[model samples]
Target: MTCMRCGREADPPPRHRIGFPAPVKERILQSICAECWKEWEGVEVKVINEYRLSFLDPQHREMLQKACFDFLKLPEQA
Candidate 1:
Protein backbone atom coordinates (compact mmCIF):
# COMPACT_ATOMS: atom_id res chain seq x y z
CA MET A 1 0.00 0.00 0.00
CA THR A 2 1.17 3.49 -0.75
CA CYS A 3 1.12 6.19 1.90
CA MET A 4 -1.31 8.92 0.91
CA ARG A 5 0.72 11.62 2.66
CA CYS A 6 4.32 10.78 1.74
CA GLY A 7 3.73 8.39 -1.14
CA ARG A 8 5.99 5.71 0.30
CA GLU A 9 5.21 2.09 -0.45
CA ALA A 10 4.59 0.03 2.65
CA ASP A 11 2.98 -3.11 3.94
CA PRO A 12 -0.74 -3.19 4.54
CA PRO A 13 -1.88 -1.63 7.80
CA PRO A 14 -2.75 -3.72 10.80
CA ARG A 15 -6.25 -3.78 12.20
CA HIS A 16 -7.38 -0.60 13.89
CA ARG A 17 -9.65 0.06 16.81
CA ILE A 18 -13.34 -0.85 16.70
CA GLY A 19 -14.99 2.56 17.00
CA PHE A 20 -13.63 5.87 15.69
CA PRO A 21 -16.54 7.63 13.99
CA ALA A 22 -16.39 6.74 10.30
CA PRO A 23 -14.60 9.77 8.91
CA VAL A 24 -11.84 9.64 11.51
CA LYS A 25 -11.33 5.94 10.89
CA GLU A 26 -11.24 6.50 7.14
CA ARG A 27 -8.58 9.17 7.58
CA ILE A 28 -6.46 6.69 9.47
CA LEU A 29 -7.07 3.66 7.26
CA GLN A 30 -6.73 5.63 4.06
CA SER A 31 -4.50 8.71 4.20
CA ILE A 32 -2.15 8.31 7.17
CA CYS A 33 0.38 5.52 6.71
CA ALA A 34 1.99 3.42 9.43
CA GLU A 35 5.19 5.44 9.59
CA CYS A 36 3.26 8.65 9.71
CA TRP A 37 0.98 7.14 12.27
CA LYS A 38 3.97 6.31 14.45
CA GLU A 39 5.16 9.87 14.17
CA TRP A 40 1.68 11.07 14.94
CA GLU A 41 1.72 9.07 18.13
CA GLY A 42 4.62 11.11 19.36
CA VAL A 43 2.95 14.32 18.32
CA GLU A 44 -0.21 13.20 20.06
CA VAL A 45 1.68 12.56 23.24
CA LYS A 46 3.07 16.06 23.18
CA VAL A 47 -0.29 17.59 22.50
CA ILE A 48 -1.86 15.58 25.25
CA ASN A 49 0.80 16.72 27.67
CA GLU A 50 0.83 20.33 26.60
CA TYR A 51 -2.91 20.59 26.66
CA ARG A 52 -3.20 18.54 29.85
CA LEU A 53 -5.84 16.36 28.27
CA SER A 54 -7.51 13.38 29.86
CA PHE A 55 -8.81 10.64 27.60
CA LEU A 56 -11.81 10.06 29.82
CA ASP A 57 -13.32 13.34 28.76
CA PRO A 58 -15.22 13.34 25.49
CA GLN A 59 -14.16 16.94 24.81
CA HIS A 60 -10.53 16.08 25.32
CA ARG A 61 -10.82 13.07 23.06
CA GLU A 62 -12.34 15.27 20.38
CA MET A 63 -9.53 17.76 20.82
CA LEU A 64 -6.95 15.05 20.37
CA GLN A 65 -8.81 13.67 17.35
CA LYS A 66 -8.83 17.10 15.81
CA ALA A 67 -5.14 17.43 16.50
CA CYS A 68 -4.58 14.12 14.77
CA PHE A 69 -6.48 15.36 11.75
CA ASP A 70 -4.45 18.57 11.66
CA PHE A 71 -1.18 16.71 11.99
CA LEU A 72 -2.18 14.38 9.18
CA LYS A 73 -3.42 17.27 7.06
CA LEU A 74 -6.80 15.58 6.65
CA PRO A 75 -9.69 17.87 5.95
CA GLU A 76 -11.94 18.70 8.87
CA GLN A 77 -15.36 17.12 8.86
CA ALA A 78 -18.01 19.07 7.01
Candidate 2:
Protein backbone atom coordinates (compact mmCIF):
# COMPACT_ATOMS: atom_id res chain seq x y z
CA MET A 1 0.00 0.00 0.00
CA THR A 2 1.09 3.59 -0.56
CA CYS A 3 0.89 6.06 2.29
CA MET A 4 -1.02 9.13 1.22
CA ARG A 5 0.69 11.37 3.74
CA CYS A 6 4.29 10.31 3.06
CA GLY A 7 3.96 8.86 -0.42
CA ARG A 8 5.90 5.74 0.53
CA GLU A 9 5.15 2.11 -0.04
CA ALA A 10 4.57 0.36 3.26
CA ASP A 11 2.51 -2.25 5.03
CA PRO A 12 -0.84 -0.96 6.10
CA PRO A 13 -1.40 -0.17 9.75
CA PRO A 14 -3.61 -2.20 12.04
CA ARG A 15 -7.24 -1.16 11.84
CA HIS A 16 -8.07 2.05 13.67
CA ARG A 17 -11.82 1.85 13.69
CA ILE A 18 -12.70 4.08 16.56
CA GLY A 19 -15.12 6.87 15.72
CA PHE A 20 -14.80 6.49 11.95
CA PRO A 21 -17.42 5.13 9.59
CA ALA A 22 -16.80 1.98 7.52
CA PRO A 23 -15.85 3.77 4.32
CA VAL A 24 -13.39 6.00 6.13
CA LYS A 25 -11.87 2.98 7.81
CA GLU A 26 -11.40 1.32 4.45
CA ARG A 27 -9.76 4.46 3.07
CA ILE A 28 -7.35 4.59 5.99
CA LEU A 29 -6.44 0.95 5.63
CA GLN A 30 -5.77 1.40 1.95
CA SER A 31 -3.99 4.78 2.00
CA ILE A 32 -2.26 5.27 5.33
CA CYS A 33 0.85 3.39 6.41
CA ALA A 34 1.65 2.41 9.98
CA GLU A 35 4.28 5.08 10.54
CA CYS A 36 2.00 7.92 9.54
CA TRP A 37 -0.84 6.48 11.55
CA LYS A 38 1.44 6.23 14.56
CA GLU A 39 2.41 9.84 14.05
CA TRP A 40 -1.25 10.75 13.96
CA GLU A 41 -1.79 9.00 17.29
CA GLY A 42 0.65 11.39 18.91
CA VAL A 43 -0.92 14.39 17.24
CA GLU A 44 -4.38 13.18 18.19
CA VAL A 45 -3.50 13.25 21.83
CA LYS A 46 -2.07 16.72 21.59
CA VAL A 47 -5.12 17.97 19.74
CA ILE A 48 -7.53 16.54 22.28
CA ASN A 49 -5.59 17.97 25.17
CA GLU A 50 -4.89 21.33 23.58
CA TYR A 51 -8.52 21.82 22.71
CA ARG A 52 -9.80 20.36 25.96
CA LEU A 53 -12.06 18.11 23.98
CA SER A 54 -14.46 15.76 25.64
CA PHE A 55 -15.90 12.86 23.75
CA LEU A 56 -19.15 13.33 25.61
CA ASP A 57 -20.06 16.10 23.23
CA PRO A 58 -21.07 15.33 19.65
CA GLN A 59 -19.45 18.49 18.36
CA HIS A 60 -16.19 17.55 20.03
CA ARG A 61 -16.30 14.19 18.30
CA GLU A 62 -16.85 15.87 14.96
CA MET A 63 -13.95 18.22 15.62
CA LEU A 64 -11.71 15.29 16.43
CA GLN A 65 -12.78 13.56 13.23
CA LYS A 66 -11.93 16.68 11.28
CA ALA A 67 -8.57 16.86 12.95
CA CYS A 68 -7.90 13.24 12.06
CA PHE A 69 -8.81 13.80 8.43
CA ASP A 70 -6.65 16.90 8.25
CA PHE A 71 -3.69 15.31 9.96
CA LEU A 72 -3.89 12.25 7.76
CA LYS A 73 -4.35 14.43 4.69
CA LEU A 74 -7.42 12.46 3.66
CA PRO A 75 -10.00 14.06 1.42
CA GLU A 76 -13.12 15.41 3.09
CA GLN A 77 -15.52 12.91 1.54
CA ALA A 78 -13.23 10.07 0.65
Candidate 3:
Protein backbone atom coordinates (compact mmCIF):
# COMPACT_ATOMS: atom_id res chain seq x y z
CA MET A 1 0.00 0.00 0.00
CA THR A 2 0.97 3.66 -0.43
CA CYS A 3 1.14 6.23 2.30
CA MET A 4 -1.87 8.53 2.14
CA ARG A 5 0.10 11.53 3.40
CA CYS A 6 3.49 11.13 1.70
CA GLY A 7 2.69 8.87 -1.25
CA ARG A 8 5.51 6.54 -0.27
CA GLU A 9 5.19 2.80 -0.65
CA ALA A 10 4.46 0.95 2.58
CA ASP A 11 5.75 -2.20 4.15
CA PRO A 12 3.54 -4.98 5.48
CA PRO A 13 0.86 -3.59 7.77
CA PRO A 14 1.39 -4.01 11.47
CA ARG A 15 -1.26 -4.72 14.06
CA HIS A 16 -2.26 -1.64 16.05
CA ARG A 17 -4.79 -0.72 18.67
CA ILE A 18 -7.47 1.96 18.35
CA GLY A 19 -9.78 3.86 20.75
CA PHE A 20 -9.72 3.76 24.56
CA PRO A 21 -10.49 1.25 27.31
CA ALA A 22 -8.87 -1.89 25.91
CA PRO A 23 -9.30 -0.48 22.41
CA VAL A 24 -11.86 -1.75 19.91
CA LYS A 25 -11.12 -5.25 18.70
CA GLU A 26 -10.29 -5.75 15.01
CA ARG A 27 -9.77 -2.03 14.67
CA ILE A 28 -7.04 -0.52 12.58
CA LEU A 29 -5.88 2.76 14.10
CA GLN A 30 -4.02 3.69 10.93
CA SER A 31 -3.80 1.87 7.63
CA ILE A 32 -1.48 4.30 5.93
CA CYS A 33 1.96 3.32 4.68
CA ALA A 34 4.99 3.32 7.01
CA GLU A 35 6.51 6.53 5.71
CA CYS A 36 3.30 8.38 6.36
CA TRP A 37 3.14 6.85 9.80
CA LYS A 38 6.65 8.16 10.52
CA GLU A 39 5.61 11.70 9.62
CA TRP A 40 2.38 11.39 11.55
CA GLU A 41 4.18 9.95 14.58
CA GLY A 42 5.86 13.30 15.07
CA VAL A 43 2.51 14.99 15.58
CA GLU A 44 0.49 12.08 16.89
CA VAL A 45 -0.16 13.48 20.34
CA LYS A 46 -1.30 16.89 19.11
CA VAL A 47 -3.45 15.39 16.38
CA ILE A 48 -5.15 12.86 18.64
CA ASN A 49 -5.84 15.48 21.29
CA GLU A 50 -7.33 17.81 18.71
CA TYR A 51 -9.51 15.01 17.38
CA ARG A 52 -10.83 14.29 20.86
CA LEU A 53 -11.51 17.94 21.57
CA SER A 54 -13.27 18.45 18.24
CA PHE A 55 -15.88 15.88 19.21
CA LEU A 56 -16.66 17.53 22.53
CA ASP A 57 -19.75 19.65 23.15
CA PRO A 58 -19.72 23.23 21.84
CA GLN A 59 -19.35 24.72 25.31
CA HIS A 60 -15.88 23.16 25.48
CA ARG A 61 -14.64 24.45 22.14
CA GLU A 62 -12.76 27.38 23.55
CA MET A 63 -10.96 25.31 26.14
CA LEU A 64 -10.27 22.57 23.63
CA GLN A 65 -8.90 25.10 21.15
CA LYS A 66 -6.64 26.54 23.79
CA ALA A 67 -5.36 23.09 24.71
CA CYS A 68 -4.82 22.11 21.12
CA PHE A 69 -2.96 25.34 20.37
CA ASP A 70 -0.76 24.80 23.39
CA PHE A 71 0.02 21.25 22.33
CA LEU A 72 0.85 22.36 18.81
CA LYS A 73 3.12 25.18 20.05
CA LEU A 74 1.02 27.64 18.04
CA PRO A 75 -0.34 30.95 19.22
CA GLU A 76 -4.00 30.94 20.10
CA GLN A 77 -6.22 32.92 17.78
CA ALA A 78 -8.01 35.83 19.33
TM-score computed on alpha carbons, candidate 3? 0.34
Lowest lDDT 10-residue stretch of candidate 3: 19-28
lDDT for each candidate structure = 0.75, 0.85, 0.42
Candidate 1 residue-wise lDDT, 50-72, digit = tens: 99999888999899888887887
What are the per-residue Cα lDDT tens digits for candidate 2 across 1-78? 889899999988787534566777788888989899889888989999999999898899889888999999898774
For 1-78, candidate 3 gives per-residue lDDT tens digits of 644344556662344522222221121123345444344445656654656655456645555444433543334442
Which prediction has the highest lDDT against the true structure? Answer: 2
List of clashing residue pairs for candidate 2: none
Worst 10 residues of 1 by lDDT: 11-20
Candidate 3 local accuracy as lDDT?
0.42
What is residue 58's positional error in candidate 2, in angstroms?
Answer: 2.0
Model 3 clash pairs are none
- Scored by TM-score, the top model is 2
lDDT of 1 at 10: 75
